[model samples]
Structures are given as structure tokens and as C-alpha cells.
Target: MAIRGKTILITGASSGLGRAMALSLSHGDNNLVVTARREGLLRELAAEVEAHGSRCTVAVADAVDPAACQQVIDAGLAAYGRIDVAILNAGGGTPTNMAHTDSAAVLRIMRVNFDTLVNFLCPMIDHMRDVGGTIAWTGSPAGFFGLPRSGPYSAAKAAGRVMLDSARVELAGSPVKLVALYPGFTYTPGLDPNDVPIKALIIQPERAAREMLGAIERGRSHHMFPKRIRVLIALGRLMPEWLRRRFLRVASGG
Candidate 1:
């Protein structure tokens, strides 16, 4: 599955991981559908993607909104005859204390992180099952465990991890491939310092994007950035629940 000539739709393309992926895949003949809430930035991205001699369409959409997410899919279908890859990369972390975090804030985080995936999955699955395609949901190291100050992010990403991993059994042998792309402390504007158990080994968004695209091209089930964290996540899962909780507490400024 070379990405060169494929039609791919990417959310959160205004900046961060989504932007990096879009730029990286811009060189080929792929028809790109890039979406974000910021219309101005999306227009600029369209110019950049087109400069590479590929087709690009910009859609101003807020992934947290169900209507906006559907619009993204519709925009892609209208621009390209078919969709080959969908990068469900809209997400953010909210700083909240467990003692008394606002429910509204938690819901916003979940909407951006989890609900968007579910909403997009409906159209993605249907289109892919009928015409064939691939979907990559952005999971996070936060998904691997619960952490203080990032409870909502942790829970939502954990749910994403579970969903993408389990989707394989349901879609086995189908032309459509589902995957979870997990990144730990990857570089992004204002989110560079994604502190975790370890302070070192954080990577840039482009590096992780390369790995993710490679996995998607090869049809791998899941792709984890900064392999060190993937190994640590495996270890954490093997640890006792009490020990995992204690470790997360210490790692997350408890």
C-alpha cells in the first residue's frame, strides 16, 4: 500500500502530527483531504500540499462535532472518487486535577479524542468495506496507563487502544485495515514537553509520522513511536494493578 497515489483524509491538519503527515505525503500523486477548525490555516495547508504537484482539498471542521466529522468524510468523497487511508488524528490533552476537574472540560477532551474516532469510524468502515480503505486511530502512551493531571486524555486514549486492537478480530481478512498509532511525548507546538516516567528520548512529530505511514503502508496492526515506550507499556501491563497505579502517580507529579 504505497501512499504515493492513494486518496487519504487527515484530521487536525492545522498543526502537529497531522500537519507533518500531510506534508510528508504531499510529494506523491495522492489526493489529500485535510481538515481542521481553522479555515485560514487549512487554506494555507492546501497551497503547500498542492505545491508538491498533488491534489489537496481543505475543509474547516471541528472533529469534536459529529456534523463536522461527517463533513470531513463527505468533502473527501466529493474531491476524490475513493478514499484509501484515513488518519483520525484529532485530539488534545486537558489539564485537570482529579480533586475537582470540570465535567465540561473532561467531555471536551473525550469528544476530541474518542467520540471523533467513533463518528468517523462509521463512514470510514462503510466506505472501506464497500470500496476498500485503511483507518489509523491515534492512540497515545497515555492510553497505556492512568496518570495524574491527564486523566481524561488517559481514559479516552485507553479506550481508543482497546477499540483499534479489538477491531482486527471483527475485520479479519477484509481489505480494510484498522490500526492504532501510539506516540509518546512526540514534538508538537506547545506540547513538546509531554512528561512521563522518563524525561529523555522524546521524538519529533515527523519521525513518528514516518513510522506510522510505514506501518500503514505495510498493513501492520499497530505502530508505536519511540519504541522504548512501547516496551515500557508492555512491562506496565504485566505489572500488578497497585504497582501500575503507584508508578503512574510517581511519574505524573503525584
Candidate 2:
């Protein structure tokens, strides 16, 4: 379905790809409910959305909290009566050396990347089971396999990606459409790579948002881009363990 004339909820709207999606989709008959922990940025985004002739609700909440996630969804429903689409996009991760990273750091990454989505997803599925809606998430190509210095993040994303893929099968013929968006390295505010070698693979947030929006509109169950990184990831998966480890060690700056 076209994104126009729909009630949409986007988490992590304060910056990065979420911000871009909100801005791109804000126009005409759209009613947007944007949520993020940063109240100031969310308010700024709300103003921009309203300026575009669309209704917007700013929800300041942490995605990791189930109550906070529910509150945002509740606010959306209260404001617009229904949510036709939800983009579960709140997530961030920091690079770490697994050999030295603390357990707390690992858990933090898992909760941010996986638990956050689960918190909102439960409510979304409950409300949309009968009425039907579209649910999309920001997964990563890194999720397909473990990446050096990002083991926890890869695990969390893999969990989310596999769950969504399974849900797509189980919910087949159901009104709700589950979309798993696997984006390659994208240049977003949260991503500041000290290693310049990684920069070559990074696409801009605007480009990633457009691709994600197009996938959601087309009701695709799984979408991965851009083609260059996707091909690299695909090829990586086919390599044997020794070769794959060598490739990752070099790419991650051994």
C-alpha cells in the first residue's frame, strides 16, 4: 500500500534513518507518530512534519522499556484512532573487542537491538491482529553472520531478523505484513567509523530511507541493499570459516 494517507509510527525519529523516513513520508494525508528518548529532537521533527501539512504526534520514550513502547503506540492510536504502519527503528551499537568487552556491554547491545523491537512488536501485533497493518524493522546485513568487533550486535540482529522471517511465514494470509529490512553500512548520525576503510561501503541515510520505504510500500517480506554490500555479504556467507574470519579480521582492522 502507498504510504500516503496512512497513520504511521516510527521509533528513533530523533536522528539518522528514522529522521529521514519521517521527513520523507510527512506530506498530504499522513498522520505520523514519532518516538525517541530525545524530546528536543523529536519536537523539532514534529514541527517539520506539521509544516509539511501532515499531523504529527511526538512521543518521547525509550524503546527498551515495554511500558514506554506501549505508551507511544497508545498515543498514536489515541491521536489517530489507528496505526496503519509502524517502523521499529530504534537501535544503536558500539564496536567492541569481544576478547575484552564486558558482559554489561554485550547485554546493552542485545537489549537495544532486539528487546526494543520486541517491546513494540507485541503491542503492534495485538492491536493489528484483526485490523491488519504493516510492520517493518531496521535489521542489518551484519545480522546474517557475526562481524568482528560487533558480535553482540550481530547476534541481536540475527535474532530479530530470523524471528521476523519466521513471523512472515506464520502470519501468511494474515492482514498484517511483516517486513525485515536489511540495510548495508549506511552513513547515519549514530555511525562514526574510525576506520576509513569501512567508509567506502556506507550509503547516506536518505538513500537507505528511500529504499526501506519502497520495500514497505511494495509489501516485500525481506529487502537488502545497496547491491554492492549485499553481494559482499552474500559472498561472505559462502566462504569457509577460516577464509571468512580472515576477511573479517582484515575488514575490521586487525
Looking at candidate 2, what is the lDDT of residue 132? 98
Candidate maximizing TM-score:
2
Tens digits of per-residue lDDT, candidate 2, 69-166, equal 99999999999999999999989889877999899999999999999999998899889889999999999887999988889989999999989878
Regions of candidate 2 where Cα sits further than 4 Å from its true position: none
- Give one digit per residue, the lDDT tens place, for model 1 in 71-157: 888888998878899999888886767689788888888877898788888779989986778898888877877777888988999
The candidate that achieves the highest lDDT relative to the unseen native structure: 2
**lDDT by candidate, in order shown:** 0.83, 0.90
The superposed Cα distance between candidate 2 and the true structure at residue 140, in angstroms, equals 0.5
Worst window of 10 by summed lDDT in candidate 2:
192-201
Cα lDDT for residue 209, candidate 1: 83
